[model samples]
Each structure stands twice: as structure tokens, then as C-alpha cells.
Target: MERQLPNFLKNYGSILLLLLGIVVGSIVGGFFPEIVAWLKPLGDIFLNLLFAAVIPLLFFAIASAVANIDGSQKLGRIISTMAGVFLGTVIIAALCTIIVLWFFPVDAPQVAQETADELLQGNPGDTWGDKLVRFVTVDEFYKLLSRENMLAFVIFSFLVGIAAMRSGETGASFRKFLISGNEVMKQLLILIMKIAPIGLGAYFAYQVGTIGPELFGFYAKPLGLYYILGAFYFIVFFSLYAYAAGGKHGVNRFWRNNILPSATAISTCSSIATMPVNLSVAPKMGIPAAVANVVIPLGTTLHKDGSSMSSIVKIYVAFVLIGWDFFDPMTLLTALGITILVSIVAGGIPNGGYIGEMLMISVYGLPTEAIPAVMIIGTLVDPMATLLNATGDNVAAMLVAKFAGARGTLSAADGLNTDDADGTD
Candidate 1:
């Protein structure tokens, strides 16, 4: 009986099952939207399970990684590598969007009166220092438990980790606790993922049933351009990055393991929600725990190639609406700079895209009337924006792994959990 089992099942059973679930859900939702609308909660239940487990998991994983660091020098190298890769990718994404907009050119659509009037007032006058303080810290420690404050938690975890490492025998004992907690979290996640195929399918069904038709709405033309551009960037550029990180093997591993995170991002439409999936997928992709834990969490808040790309398109669309020149040299340069900043600030909090749009408006001195157009643009682009934002974190981790040469129970070469020598995944 055992001999009848196939090796392909052993290697790829979960992935195939997952793909099947997505397809089935998408098809049913497409053809019979009313029937599948209620299944959304099933998906939410699955996301909630992972979210509950991940709060502590993120703490232990990140704190333990820092606690176990051999020296500050190596930690600096890891951090430096992470920052360099983030900056490089954000720049590339921004430049790509700028170049594409220059050629294709988004003309403003005649937005509906309701949309232009629907926008709420935003306080765009907040200074950079003010934004930084709020983003990096919360008034109370308990606030860190919220997923929206993930960046603050990242900072806290690093401090606690360093303190544990510095505290002699007591600290060493604490470090063990952190490591054990991290392992427990990983196991908990593996068990949670047993239901992923079903959960993700249900979620995809909800997404397609509820939201798919909106893509063909009044804003379809500009939305279409951004969607096509986002897709092209997601596939072509990410593949190039993977190849650069580890050649064909890197590309193969990245593609195989990334589907879950990509799906989760599209379904949940939040980078923070997808972090756990990325954490689980990272190990299976051979990302060192240190690199995976840090980069993914930080990337959840700090790295946003999709958001950056979308910001440029929003700028172009808003400028067009306001009767401003889209390509004035100094003004274009400012928009490019805003793309990087908006990517960071817009994603740092929940529902922050609204604030990002306001920032763009304030910076460009656009009339409040332009708000509705960009707001709609943001709404339409969010799912794909999130996919790129979340999955690109894993890609950045791979590049950091290549640059930093992280060593532990796993090696990039070991591709330990990545799979057999047959492939990196």
C-alpha cells in the first residue's frame, strides 16, 4: 500500500492541493457569486488563526534571531544588506513606473461627482518628524500587540533580544526561551497551514465574487494600465531579482514557494496579514531565520514596491486632473521622491493609503477636488499592490541572504527546507 504512493505527492502535494483550491473557488465565485458569498468567514477564520499565532511568533522569531547573533558586526552586516536591497528595489520599482507612465501616459478620467465629493478631510500638514515618531513607537507597550504597529514591534523585539543576549547566564536562559518559543511558533504554523488549501480557496472565492466585477467599472482605463503594469512588474522584475540572487535555482525556489504568500496577500489585501505566510514560506524557501524574520516584518511596514509603483501612477493621474504638467523636471523629481516615501508611510498603518494620497495632494498643492480620483485609483489597485508588497519581501530576503551569507541550522546552499537537490523549492 505504501509503495503505491507517488514521490511527486511527497514533494508537491500541498502546492497542488492549494492551486486546486484557488481554481475551484475562483470558478465557483465567478459563475455563481451569490452561492459562495457566505464562505468568506471560513477564510477569515483561517486568517485569524494564523494572525493569533503570529503575534507571538513574530516576537520570538525576531528577538531570538538577534539574541543568537554571534556578534554586533555580523548583525550590522545583515541590517546593512537588508537596507541596501530594500532601497535598491524601491528605486527600481519607482523608476520603472515612472518610465512606463512617461510612455503610456495616464490621462485623468472624468470622475463622478459622488467620488470627488466622497473623500474625507485628511490632515496632510503633519511633518516628517511627527510621522516618524508615530510610526516607530506607540504610547503603551500593549499597543505593540496590534498588527498595525508591526514596525514598532520590530524595534522592540530587537531591543529585548539584545538585552537577553547581554544578560549573562540569566540572559542566556531567556535567549533559550525565545528560541524555544520561536520553534513552537513554527510548529504551530505548520499545523495551521494544514487547512490553508481550503481557507485560501474560500478567500479567493470571496475576492472574486465580491470584487472582481468592480475592475470593469468607470475607472477601468487607468485601473487597467496600473493592473497591467503591476502584473508585469510582479512577474518580470521579481523573476529577474530571484535569478540575480541565486541564478536559476533561486528563481525556481522563489516561484514555487511564493504562491501561498501571493494568494494570501490578494485575499487579505494587507501586508501585515501575509507576514506569517511569508514566515512559514521563508523557511521552505531556505531563507535564514535571521534574514527572514527581520526582512519580512520590516518589509511589511517599510518595503512596498507595489505601493511605490502605484503612487507614481496616482501622481500622474492627479496631475492630469488638476491641469498641471505631468512631466515638469523639478516636479517630476519630487514625485519620484514621494513615491519612495509614500510607499513607506502609506503602508505603516491600517487604511493608510488614504493618508498617502493626501500627502501626494499636499506636496503637489493639488486641489481637494483631485482627492476622489486618486482615492478610487488606490482602491482599485490595492489587491495587486499588496501582492507585490508582501511577496517582494521574500525576494528581498533572498538577496540579503546572498549578500550577507547567513549561516545557521540552515544554509542557502542547504536549501534545507527548500526541497531536494531536484530543485531549490
Candidate 2:
């Protein structure tokens, strides 16, 4: 049992982490509440470092991808495919949030008004007009790029890369600089990678130390539910979508070919970190360079089905905990909008969700402290989300490969030659 357990657990780190988080969160919440305060700082430190790497990683990745496109720009096809997957994922996430709300129903147990009041009292914010003013200022614009607000950073990088590509010698030098910056960030990320396990462990320990055993009930089943929902959406719905968009072999070949990268993404829990593996595996999977180059990096920041799942689940938790009704169409629409917007905005930035949540808390007037609780639930399910996201990306890559008319090989899924299939969409 001991030897077998190791193998089983090795293939199931996400599940193990969920169990660890629950048992630990519960024990800590119940018995050692006092110590949670001390450990909280460690968790904060971990988040800070995690976020610090997000912007630079995104900047170089976007710049590098934009600089490498070949042939007549099939930009339209690429955008459409990405948009389809993204919108579909968002819709599915909204469904997940609603289901979670229906099942859990946070309002059944009334939360104290005093608790809500206390949270708001401590966290102040500007009015809408003030915020708009701040957002429009030139200083804020630069800060947005610097802060790694991925949407801005992506736009900035793409524009810069396109301009540089057009500028001949000067552009070549600029591209080199961006490439060099990316390499430097890569090295920094590698250093951070060594400590990731420690950070994960410390964050887990801190969460476990604070949340008592009773809270274990929250993660045990809901966590599993979220993972299964994410898998169903990607493996079933999105896979079918791939077949419709490209061909049967598109989904199958993509999945089988990129399984290693998918698994690496799940294990590492950092999609950005998994780029080398993804890039290396894409060609072997028969994906074209043009498609693979643009799709994967953009997908890492833009196409986050995993984070989408988290946003959906968290929205449901918010409504349920606040005792709001999910059956209301307005409520569902609000959740959907927030999930998509947050997914896009946050997916762009390095630790986009972390910052995005602050905006959410202020905008929606939800309990800010509850952010930690939502993260606890989301992080537990993140690995599964990553697997789903990686799978979706490969599927998209295959579709894009077909459209690009690049060197194609027989898809591993059904032994069909995509290049010879002769398809027009």
C-alpha cells in the first residue's frame, strides 16, 4: 500500500493538495487560530513574489510571440478561435457558479452584519468618478503597464512588437532587447521555481493552521465538483468544438500529443512556467509554428479556463454566502459578466486575480476577508483547472494549425492526416 500510494499520489498532486488544505485548514481554524495571524504574513509574502513575476513574464511572452508570426496573417482565424473558447469557458464557469450556489446556499446560515461592517470599515476606496479619473491619468497608464495589468501589457507588447518588426534594423534591436528581457525573467522565474514548493507548503500550512476542521466540509466535495466541471467543459465540450472547427483528429491528436505538457502544467500549477514544455511539445504534436507561437503564450495569459472556473465558483460563493438568490436572471447575468471580465482582466496581469479581486470587492461591496476563503477553494482546484486549460490550448493549436496550411502530420488521435483532409471553414 505504501509503495502503491506513492505512485497514485504522484499522479494526483492536485487531489493531495486539496486533502492537505482541507485537513490542515480545518485543524488550524479549529484549534490553533492564534497562530494563523503569524503565518498569514508568510502567505502574503508568497503571493507578493508570485505576482511580482506575472508582469515581466507576460510582457516578454507577448512580445516574443508577436515578433515570430509568418506568412499572410491568419489573425482573424486565430482571434475567432480564441474568442470562441474564451466565451464558451466563461459561460460554463457561470453555470458552475450557479450550481455551487444552488447546492451550498451561504445565506442559510446568516452572517453577522457586524462582520460585513468591519470589513468595509477597514477597506476604503474612491468613488466611480474618482476611479475613472485615476484610471485615465497618464501616470496611471504607465503604472498599469508596469503593474502587469496583462490586458494593457499585451496591447503594449503587441503594438511595440509590430512596430519593431516594421522598423527594420531598429526593430531588430528592439526585438533583441525584448527577447533578452524575456530570458532574464525566465532565469528569475527558474530561481523562483525552486522555492515554489516551499511557498506552496508554507501557504498550505498557514491556511491549515488557521481554518479548523469544520471548514473541511467546504473543500471536500465542492473542490471535486469544480474540477469535474472544468474537465467536462474542456475535455468534452471544447474537444467537440475543436472537432467542429477543425476535424475529429484535431481534438484527439492535440490531447494525446500534448498530454506531457498538460501534465506538466497540472503538476507545476504555473502555466507561464510550462511554456518551454508546451513550445517543445507543439511541433511534435504536428502543430504549425505560427499557430503554436501565438496561441500558447496568448493562451497562457488570455485563455485561462482554470482561472475562469475559479472566478465562477467564487462568484457563486459570494452570492450564496451573502444569502442572495441565484435563480434570479439578473444575478446570473451579473455573475457571468463579472466572471468573463475578471477572467480576461486578471488573466492578462501576472497575479491578475489577486488584484482583480480588490476591484471586485470594492465594486460589488462584498466582504473583502472572504477573498482568502474563495482563494482557498480555488487554489485547491487550480491544478485541475490548469490541466483543462492546457488541453484547451492544444485543441486550439490544432485548429489554428489547420487554418495556417503549415507542415502537418497525422494526428495521433485517430491516425488521420490533417494536411491531406482538405478542409475549408
Candidate 3:
């Protein structure tokens, strides 16, 4: 009887459960708002668990992936190709967003006078040089533990990985140890995820209940548009990329295997949370562990198609609210540059879109009063945006593997053993 359950549901049951939670929570919250409000802590605890795993998981996964690379020249080629593709795709996404916004302009909501006054008073003084300095160097080792310093940790990990790779036997031993640690972290993540449905349910319920259905009605037009465009990118853009990297069959297989991860990203609204699912499925999709390990972790930090799209939308919305001409050549240029930069650094941050919102304010020279307005748009569109980002990471991995001269599609045997930390047969 248990075996009679459908394969897709069994495989993606967590997402189903999460959706159930959302629906049920919304209903209960709608009828009895006070009870659902009390459930907020359940969701908060789960989110914290997910965030706790991110820093260590990223550090170990990335370092192990780089150390495991066969040689420096090969790693160089892979990294270069991957970076080019990542940037190109993000630019394309941003352009598409701009085009869409140009054709269908969204009216921005008015900010409260008090809110505007509060927002305009703060000074963020973070220049490009300051950001660069922060990225490349940490003032203290402990600073790396802070969520805002993820880029610094990534840089440090890359150097450690390269040094370990060059250390011959010593490096090899260390790499093994790092790999083991990564495995342990994956296991920890799995245990945390076991309770995700409850956490997500409580969270979504509280959100929907407190905000009420009127909130959706208020933002429906823009949110609906964002979801439609995001889906187009996920299904159309990714499928086309998959077809190019592999073929018709490869596209079919890639889409089939990606269901769970994409669903998870949409439900959780997190690319970081989706990493484990991507790592597990990459092998099944024929991506080499060496490539998946490096690319997926790195992509989690550097690649963010969903956030890029969301940023473009937010910037456009902000422009309309502020009465700025978005079509100006200089305006377009600035948006492109800042969106790309913000998307790259936005990953691994706990609040998702808060940092990106600040970058838009700083780079676009918007009034500090604009932050609340931009955040509203971000909150509305984040889930769909994250779905695109998480799914795009898998597509990026496949493309990187192909460009780096991986022989056609490797078998599942060539992939990582997702069941164990060591990934052994």
C-alpha cells in the first residue's frame, strides 16, 4: 500500500506538505488570526536552523570542491567559463525585466510621511572601495562568522583551497577531512529539513493571516507579472540553455530531475536552503561531483538570476515612485551595473532582499525614504524569484560541465553518492 504512492509525490512530498501548511495556516489565520500569530516562533526557529548551516556548509563545500579539482589549468578554464555564463545570463535576465517593465509600467505605492522621514535620516557611506576592501580582507577571523561577511569568507576559502591543492599529500589529506566535514553538514541540513514543513506552514500562515487576503489583492498585479516572467525564464530560458548544453533528451531529463529542488526553492523562498537538494540531484542529472560541488556552492554565493530579475523590477518600481526616467541611457547603464553587483553579493544573507534593497538605494541615488517601498515589492516577489535562482544554478552546473569538456552525459555511477557524507559507492 505504501509502495502504491505516486513517485513524484513521494519524492516531492516535503513541498506538498509545505503547501498544505500554507493553505491550512492561511485558512486558520483567516478565521482565527490570534492563534496563527502565536505560531510565528515555530517558523522562526526553522529559518534560524537553515541559516545556521549556510556559513559552514558554504566554506567546506567550496574549499573541498576546489581542492578536488584535477589541476589548476582545468580549474581555471572551468571557473572562467562558468563566470562568463553566469554574468551573461544575469544581464539577459535584467534586460528582459527592463523590457517587460517598459511595456507594462507598475504604479508604486505611496510611502507614509513619517516612514519617509525616518528612512532619509540614515547615512550608509559604503563606497565601492569600501565594499572591495571588505570582500578581500576581514578585520578579524571572527568577522567571517557574521552573515554580512560571506564574500570575505569565500575569498578566504578560495585561497585556502588553492594552497591545499598545491600542498600535494598534505593538501590531499586536508581535502579529505574537509569533504568529511561537508558530509556531516549535509546530514545536519537533512535533519533540519525534516521539520521544514511545520516551520514553513507556521510562517506562511502567520504571514498570510496577519497580512490578510487584502495584501495579495493590493500587490496582485505586480506579483502576478513577476511570477509569469520568472516562470518564463525558468521554463523557457533554462530549457533552451539545457537544449544547447545537451540536446532534446537532456532537456527532458534535466527538467524531470529538477522538480523537487525548484519546488523547495519556491516554498522556502531560499536558494541557500535549496542547495542540498541541488547537490543531491546533480549526480542523477549526470553532473560530475567535482563540477557540481564547486559550481553549486559557488553559484549559491555568486549566481542569482532570480535576485537580478527582482532587483530590476524593484528599481523600475522605485523609479516610477520617485518619478525618475528609467529609459535614459545612463539610467539603464547604472541599473545594469548595480543589479549585477548586488545580485552577486546578495547570496547567503539571512534577510534575502534587505542588502539588495540598500544597494539600489545607494547606487541609484534614491531617497532613503524609498527603502520601505522597495522592500514591499521584494517581499511580494521573493518566492518566485528564488525559484528562478535555485533552478538556474542547476542549469548553470550542466552548462559548465559541458563547456569544460565533460564527455557527454556521465552516468549516475560517476555522480556523487548523496546518501553518505563521503559520497562513496
Top-scoring candidate (TM-score):
2
What's the distance in Å from true for residue 169, model 3? 19
Residue 359 miss distance in model 3 (angstroms): 1.3
lDDT of 2 by residue, 90-121 (tens): 57656765676577544322332324434433
- The parts of candidate 2 lying over 4 Å away from their true place are 1-29, 48-114, 121-168, 186-212, 246-302, 314-375, 397-425
Q: What's the lDDT for residue 394 in model 2?
A: 64
TM-score of candidate 3 relative to the true fold: 0.58
| Model 1 superposed RMSD (Cα) | 11.1
Each prediction's total of clashing residue pairs, residues at least 3 apart in sequence or on different chains, is 1, 15, 0
Which pairs of residues collide in model 1?
Answer: 418-425
Which scores greater on TM-score, model 1 or model 2? 2
Q: lDDT winner between 2 and 3, please give it.
A: 3
* lDDT tens digits by residue: candidate 3, 1-425: 56546644654465566557656766776888879768888877875675567578667766776677675335776788789879988999999898887887765334322233443432378887885686457899998875556556767877787887878886777989988986787677677767766776676567566556653454566667788899888889999888867677557657767888877886666788889999998876777777888789878877889888888888876676556667898789878886786676566544436556655665555664455446556765767878888888888988888878754343323343434322221
In order of appearance, the predictions have TM-scores of 0.58, 0.62, 0.58
Scored by Cα lDDT, where does model 1 land? 0.73
Question: Candidate 2 versus the native: TM-score?
Answer: 0.62
